[model samples]
Target: MSDRRLTPELLLGAYAAGVFPMAETRDASEIFWVDPERRGILPLDGFRMSRSLARRMRSGRFRATLDRSFPQVLDGCADRDETWINGTIRDLMLDLHALGPAHSFEVWEGEKLAGGMYGIALGGAFFGESMFSRVTDGSKMVLAAALDHLRRCGFTLFDTQFLTPHLASLGGVEITRAAYRARLARALADRASIDAIAMDGDLQAVVQRMTHTS
Candidate 1:
């Protein structure tokens, strides 16, 4: 393992090498690299939108946006008691965004941020870093938009890094590192443009598309 600092360059390099960085705690100044034996990923074409979530999508109570409120989204993800996002990690992600290697999706209700997610985009792979929700179903709304956008953009992989119960409910699954590497390689071989798709944040439209394709 290389003792590289968590600079933008190092972070990008780590992702390129199929590893990611994490801090020990929210207050930790130092960061470490992670390459888990079991990797969590959401199938772009297999994302599950439950009947209730689909109804929520049709409710039109929330709105979603891409690459908006990125910092706020990052902060929201790290707002919990235990977090790996420290100041250094935050700055690094911001730098990645500036270079167009990172992107975010945000959910809003009126003027307040409801939920959002951010990640690094490389070729056809989207490495999900984190997400949060303030209101009910906010995170789900943001995820729906993200999945739609990624599919429309021709992305082939949605790497969540690890699976949680919440993620599993949305069709997140675990795969061995070898399997993940194979998928990553294939995804990295293909290229997709996230900017090519013009996405509407309207919940109904998002669900309509998801239902039609999914």
Candidate 2:
């Protein structure tokens, strides 16, 4: 078992070092740091909005917002059957949120919270921690909006920790540890904020921008 006690300060330091903590299971008592040989990252300017995602974004059936309901978004992500977000990690993330470096991007379907994601933002890097969806295409739309927001906010790096099939489909790529550190150093040298740009605009604008760029 890890003897290290995770504090908000330590958590931030770990992220700065390009490592993150995870638990073996949702109920695990200890958290271990991960410094993967291959790191997954989504390029801020390279996120792909497929035809269906673009259509859904312009559908006007969903609305997106940032930091609207952070705790709710965290809960949604942790609600899955298998998760690494143990109690210790969850509470510490809450502490980080209160300290101002953590944020959530949410997608809503009318009165219901459809999907969202939460992550830690440091310098120009956004470490995507977790995401969840309750409706079809909910998570996809949220990702599209989140990437758009990141770019508009001047963020340069979007760290996904590890690549998954879903993320690869959306443009997440893996880099060797040495390569990732080079990118991370550059991102850390720069500064950015999630709220630097207002996320209050027509969702179609995001779709249009992605159509041109992606």
Candidate 3:
């Protein structure tokens, strides 16, 4: 289908049906649907924080916030050598953010944007789209904060779409499409509020909660 013509309603419907929209390249105007054979997911109760990362979080060098810079997070994710986020996708995401279908979690080191993550949320399922980091432990801090937020909001499924070494280290795992669909079904069936829980942009508090729950 044409990416330029993909509306927020169509994209939401697609996600509800267990597929997602994507562009082939940064310059591509046509968007395509994708349902990979393998899916990447993070266990809500298994998000791992290494000892060193825990120390960093305890050090309070960074702060985390949610939906603070939705557009900036999307732009940062696309600011790379190779990206599937084209102009159409970027605009759609921004629209989704405004409509509350998309949300972002950002980590700031003082006044600088250290790192952040953004994604789409439906029911109890959160589809992680992308993340970016500009300083050490920046991305990790965002991920931890996001997971904590998701858990507090009663979300059950954290869909990464694809697994990477970076995600795997933090409890991301690959699952077959069939298994993924089962989880997705359960997640969609349940009701959860992505914004029900409030975060204070406190990195240490986030870490303490994650450690206590995990």
Candidate 4:
């Protein structure tokens, strides 16, 4: 299917089928589907919290929020030198967000957006598309809080799509495509909502809970 034919329903259906669209560059007008042989996923119960990340989490230097400034978060994630989030993808995501399952987790330094991540949430699985950081450990902070939020909200699978060394250090692991499909199937059959709980609680308490759990 062509990128021009891609709609919010089609995008969500693609995610349900374990395939996603990508572009050659941010300016690319066309997009293609990608279904990797290996999938990167962060096990909800297996996130690694190092001393520094834990300390940073408890420092109260940043606050975490959900679905706030999603458009800004999208801009942040695509602000890099090279990105696969082209205009078509960005527009589609915006439409998806309006239709509801898509969400963004944001980390803030006072009124500034330090970092954030966005993804498509279907049933019990959250397909993390991209994240960006404007400050040190900003993306990491968002990831930590996103994981905690997902866990508390009853999500079962956190699909990072591809594992990077950064995510590997934070407990992301690669699994066979078959294994990933199995997990995805189960998750799709289950039920969860990223918006089920609010992020209005204490940041330090989130860190403490993650520290004890991890």
Residues 1-214 of candidate 3: C-alpha lDDT, one tens digit per residue? 2355778988899888789878888998777889989999999888899888889888877888889899999999999999989888898898899998999999988888999899999999999999999988888889998988888899999999999999999999999999999999999998999878787678788778888888
What C-alpha lDDT values do all the predictions have?
A: 0.88, 0.90, 0.89, 0.89
Assess every candidate by TM-score.
0.95, 0.96, 0.96, 0.96
lDDT of 4 at 26: 91
For candidate 1, the TM-score is 0.95
Model 3, 52: alpha-carbon shift in Å?
1.3
lDDT of 2 at 124: 95
Candidate 1 off by > 4 Å: 1-4
**Model 3: how far is 133 from its true place, Å?**
0.5
Model 3 residue pairs with clashes: 3-31
State, as a TM-score between 0 and 1, how close model 3 is to the true structure.
0.96
Query: lDDT of candidate 4?
Result: 0.89
Model 4 clashing residue pairs (backbone) = none
Q: Per-residue alpha-carbon lDDT of model 4 for 20-74, expressed as tens digits?
A: 9999999898999999999999998788877887787788788999998889999
Q: List the residue pairs that clash in candidate 2.
A: none
Which ranges of candidate 2 are over 4 A from the true structure?
1-4
Worst 10 residues of 1 by lDDT: 1-10
